[model samples]
Target: MHIFEGFLPSPWWQVWFAISIPVIMYGIYQMNKLVSQRREIVPLLAVAGAFIFVLSSLKLPSVTGSSSHPTGTGMAAILFGPAVTSVLSVIVLLYQSLFLAHGGLTTLGANVFSMGIAGPFVAYALYKVASKAGMNFYLNVFLATAIADWVTYVVTSLQLALAFPFEGSVFASFKMFALVFATTQVPLAIMEGALTALIMKYVVQVKSDVLVGLNVLTSSAATKLREAME
Candidate 1:
């Protein structure tokens, strides 16, 4: 969900900015450390940012002065974990805000918190759980991405409701915003999941070593995947 410029009043935006800055800094640090260890990750990180930029830039008008789009953060989170995904997301969001006017600078912190940090963390957690459960790889990817996309909207709804509650009740406002978002967000999330699943499958077939290098798939898992491909 992309909150337009000036949608969030003063001090609220500042509050979000204050909260997000440290996390963003940490993400940058983590990204740098990872890149130093594996120079190959640089291109992958760029590609991840580009993928997020393209998908998230395609916005559809939604309720509560926000718009809906596929986050595409799940793939990055699955590949590089949530910390690095945060860095990529901030870069993509910044570019979109500056050039595309898709989202605004004032609201960037809030957007980053909801779409970047919150969603990716959930996706990472789900991916771990699914992998440990011995779930099918594609199915795990689908669930992780789709659910992450939905959770992003959910967090956005909470953010909006907190800023401008309905009937003087934050929970009431949360439910209202959530319902409004669910209309478009659900299908969008499912589509995002399907697309991400296909991409992951293609990567597994052609560049499974990348997954192994990132520790996204274990060596045994990679071997099993190659066997299946053959």
Candidate 2:
């Protein structure tokens, strides 16, 4: 749910915006560090960002009669790490706000925290766990994206609840939101995972050397992807 302007309590929102500034700054700083280490990959990141921007422009119909688009932050995080994804997400959100008006400027920080921060971190964590558990590649992709998307929504719901006073229990509000949005969000997560895996496979194939230098693609996986791409 896009929390547009005037949707939250002004006082609480002001406090959240203030708190969010340093958090966004820290994320930006982290992205800068990551970018410095991977100077050659920066061009690839721009390509990926453009791909995400286009992909995100497409919306799929939901059971609730609302359409939702996939947030490509998880895919970016998988390739560039979450730090870069956080900054990329803010940029993407900003562009969407200005061009599409999908989410408002006032609530952009909150959106960044939810979709950008939470989505990428959760996806990265899940991917790491699944890899450690020796899960299959596709399953790892599926679960990571799914969990990350759900986490994004959950975090957003909490933000909304915290921003405004609800008449009932906070848990209840979350549950209600989950029920309404889960149908779309859950499937979106699966799509995100699959799409992320496909795109990453392409990236690894074309430039395994680059990924290896960044420690993102192992030699073997890179070789395999390269062969497949060829």
Candidate 3:
């Protein structure tokens, strides 16, 4: 969900900017270094960014003048981790803000935090946990992507509640906002999960080596998947 432009109070937006800047910088540095070492990742990253741009741009109206949509961060987070995903998210958000007017410049940092950093980090953590548990690969992707999409909306609601406490109580506002988003977001998340799962399945079948290179699939897992594909 996008918090929209001018939704946050001035100080709140500034605070988010302060929090996001350092991480974004580090992400840029990391992405540059990684691409330099593994040029093959560049096209994958581009596709990931484009996916995010398209998915997140499709917004459904929600509470407090905000809107809900699929974050599209989970797959990228699983592939490149949250840091690089953050960089890609910011770029997508910026482009949306400029031409699409989906979000706003002042609210960019807050959007980045919720949709980029928080969601992707959670997705990565869940993916690792699912993998370590030896879960089915498709199920792991579904859980990670679905849960991450939901978490992004959760964070956005919290951000809105914080900026505008309802009846002078932030908790109440948070609940209100969360409830509003849940109406549309839940089904959207499920759909995104299914789609992401299919994409992962295709990648595992056709380019298991890419997953192996990203450490998403261990060599043994990649080999097993390739054999299954055969």
Give the per-residue lDDT digits (tens) of candidate 1, residues 80-163: 899999989999988988988878999999999988899999999999998999999999999999999888899889889889
Q: Which stretches of candidate 1 lie over 4 Å from their true place?
A: 57-68
| Model 1, residue pairs in steric clash | none
Better of 1 and 3 by lDDT: 1
RMSD of every prediction: 3.2, 3.0, 3.4
List, residue by residue over 100-168, the lDDT tens digit for candidate 2: 878877787788888888888888888777777767655677677767888888888888767543586
Q: Give the per-residue lDDT of model 3 (tens digit) for 128-162.
A: 99899999888999999999989988999998999
**Model 2: runs farther than 4 Å from truth?**
35-38, 60-66, 202-210, 224-230
Each candidate structure's TM-score, on Cα atoms with residue i matched to residue i, is 0.90, 0.83, 0.88
The most accurate candidate by lDDT is 1
